[model samples]
Target chain A: MSPELARFLQDCEQDFQQALPALCQPPGSDCPAVPGGLAEAGAYSLGNGGKRIRPVLCHAAAAALGAADRTRSAAPAHALELIHTYSLIHDDLPAMDDDDLRRGQPSLHRAYDEATAILVGDGLQARAFEVIAGSDVLDAAQKVAMIGVLARASGMQGMVGGQYIDIHATGTDMDLAALQAMHQLKTGALIRAALALGGIAAGASEAQLRALDDYGRHIGLAFQVVDDILDVDGDPSALGKTGGKDAAANKPTYVKLLGLDGARQEAQQLLQAALTALETFGASADRLRELARYIVERDR
Target chain B: MSPELARFLQDCEQDFQQALPALCQPPGSDCPAVPGGLAEAGAYSLGNGGKRIRPVLCHAAAAALGAADRTRSAAPAHALELIHTYSLIHDDLPAMDDDDLRRGQPSLHRAYDEATAILVGDGLQARAFEVIAGSDVLDAAQKVAMIGVLARASGMQGMVGGQYIDIHATGTDMDLAALQAMHQLKTGALIRAALALGGIAAGASEAQLRALDDYGRHIGLAFQVVDDILDVDGDPSALGKTGGKDAAANKPTYVKLLGLDGARQEAQQLLQAALTALETFGASADRLRELARYIVERDR
Candidate 1:
């Protein structure tokens, strides 16, 4: 990555790390914390620390859009991360993917009980929108639009729907189209929202917003494709999750359908397409372009 | 109930029945229904007829505020009902209350699998905010504010947190203060939001809004107190679910702390408090007044 891109990613990550704890607390002054396991469960999962790719993408989009008050974009960025973390918590439930490990530790359900995990996910999801709606940075309209976009992406039509399809399709033979469709909703929608939220926060023109969405869609797919590839070839320690579970569970994946080399080629093509979508923004989109390359290349 | 209040409730119920189906479908034309059991699970619980108390409360508040556009309050009312339904679905999960029935029908997790029930609850919660944020009737600021209020009420300082406390306090002795705190968060928050959302929808003044909130709080506590009394004395058929489950689960409740007659006396006192809060509104709040009485008097 370029030095500038690297520095920008670091800054966004730091901002998220600092802002997230306070944001996840109960809104009222009377309540210091959520009454029981809620705060601990939420804090555990959220603090586990992934790459914060979603938030970085949001901040990158803000920069790319020439948003004057870039710090204001933090609200949407925080909201996206909260949504992502909550999805992970739910996905790791015994009734769902039943994963034991995440980010080098036990998944939320395993770390806590299934009930606490469930409430934590629900709390996080609620907090996501609450934070965005309450943000002073964005105007009311932008916040409303952001809420609609995020909710639609995270709800039945997006991540949750995709997860439903995924869980049902396990151990079944699935075609590429089916796999792509699931990934598009499950992961792609939030990623696309990350950029769209940034653009919305910045008051980007409709056309510019569309281009950012296009760029986001391409990279979103690429990120998932790479994830499938990594699952087959990744080191468990580095990945901070158990690898080969996909194959063991007989889940359909890009590597399984397209083969490793073919999947790599697909990711490369998506990387190019993502870049192409960002062409109109010229130098302003440099960080986004770098981030696209990073999505396909990241090991964790 | 007065004739006017009865008619208003019937209209809200009819409107809800008509609107909920379309509301559950995917927002965009690009996607059809969620692949499989997702839609069915959500529909099963949401379609099952509850008293629609939250929606009625919202509508009554709107009417009390003299909001000329009664139709405008539909979005928030619907949103509140969705949140309430989703909470019931989650609370019925095997790890939680482990209920087999809800509103005289099979509980969501019992009717479907646990996984589907979990996803359905998540979907409904997400859809609530989406519906509000996307509503064209309210301006953006109102939408944002409504989302914030609903999210905070439904989330970690509110319903979810209260559930956490209740579940943990099961089979344990607790005093009146702890019991009230739990009930206030578990049930009162959403009830409060229902009235608050309605008031906000009508562009109520700060004093009017605070009065609505006060009325809502008194009735919210009354509703729970009556519920505990019902659990001890209600007919299963009349209540539409088994009674005595709260005692059976060893859950903390008003009856456990106050005894049957004492709980009833508390409900009556709360009803009076609720009525007192609306005194200044005079006949404009007649429906709300009737509703407050109904809350304490209702057999179901």
Candidate 2:
């Protein structure tokens, strides 16, 4: 990664770190009415070390759309990070992915207890909306629109519902199409929303927003395909987490149906499509294109 | 409960039953692209039996605000119901409250799997917003406001946050103040939002909303007192579900702070306050006032 890209991610990480405590608590939670530890479980996962990819995509798109001053887009980007963290929290719960490890530590539910994990995920999801709506920068209409964007992606028509399908078919051998649909939901929905939120934050034009949406869609899938590839070929030490979890659980992956090389080829193809969508932006999209390339190329 | 209140409860239950399928699946989920078991787990909870108190509260408030037709408030009322159910689903998970039984039958997680319970709760939360946001009856602003109400009530600073305090403090004696704060998040927040969502759905005036908010706050705490009283003295057979679980778990309760008789008396006082709030509504508030009474007065 270039220093510029590293710097952008670092900036987002700092903003997310600062804004996170606000997102877990209910709005007006700063009042003494709420006791200490109200946000402890929520903090566990949000504080867990994970790359801020989705939030980075959001900030990058906002900056590309002439919100050149990164400071202006900080709040929405904070909300986006909360959404991403919430999804990971829920995904790692015993009922969902059942992973004992996330970012190389115990999953939220395991780290605390089951109820805490559930509430943490629930709290974070609600907090994400609260921050967006409570934000003074956006007008009511824009906040409402952003909430609409988020709700659709997080709800039944999106990630959560997608998770339901994945669990129901657990142990059932699914074909490639079933697998893709599941990944689109379990991974892609929020990625698409990240781009959508960025455009809304930057006040991008419809044409620019459309292009970013397409870009998000392709890379989102490619991101998952790369995850599948990593599970098969990447070194466990570099991944910083268990790499063979999917196959061990018999959760279907691209390689399960199409073979390891085939999945890598698919990721490459999707990355190319993501880059193609940014062709309209020319030099302005260099960062996004590079990010997409890194998403497909990363080992962990 | 009065005959009229009984009828209203039955009507609301029927409405939930009727709309259950749509609430379960993602809109356009039949696109056959996604893989979630939205229907099966949804049926596990929706097809089972439970009191529809939350939705009824929503409808009653909407009706009190003069949206007489159930169709007009179906979205918010149903959204409230789904969120309530989502809490139940998550609360029943193995890592949370871990109740093996609910509504006189197996809990959703126990009946299915932990993953199913998690996804079911996630799906319901998502579905609640989908129902409200996708509604044609309420304007976009109304939808956003309703989402905020639901999110705040159910999130960390609300129900889930309360659960965290409850679980974290398990096996230790809690002060009266700590117990009350826990219940405010666990039980009070949702009840408050139940009233608020109904009012928002009906586009209630500021004064009416303030009145309802007060009524909601008083009654919500009162309802918890009644629950704790039941945990101490009620008969499980009559209650139709387990009542001794709180005591067995050594969780804090109003009965623990105030004696059983004192808790009952407090409930009665809160009932009067709720009734006073409804004094201006004349006959339209009859059902709502009765619900406040029933929420406290019922043996369960």
Summarize candidate 1's per-residue lDDT along A165-273 as a digit string, tens digits.
Answer: 9888999999999899999988998999999999988889999999999999999999999999999998888898889989999999999999999999999999999
Worst 10 residues of 1 chain A by lDDT: A24-33
What is the per-residue lDDT of model 2 for residues A208-292, given as tens digits with 9 covering 90 to 100?
9899999998999999888888898889888877777788888888888889989988998999899889888867677788899
| Model 1 lDDT, residue A188, Cα | 93
B60-97 in candidate 2: lDDT tens per residue? 89889888778767888887777788888887777777
Interface RMSD of each: 1.5, 2.7
lDDT of each: 0.88, 0.77
Highest TM-score: give the candidate number.
Answer: 1
Q: List model 1 lDDT by residue over B143-222, tens digit each.
A: 98899999999999899998988888888889999888888899999999999999989888999989999999999999
The 10 consecutive residues of candidate 2 chain A with the worst lDDT sum are A26-35
- What TM-score quantifies how close candidate 2 is to the native fold? 0.92
Interface RMS deviation of candidate 1: 1.5
| Residue B78 C-alpha lDDT in model 2 | 80
lDDT of 2 at B37: 58
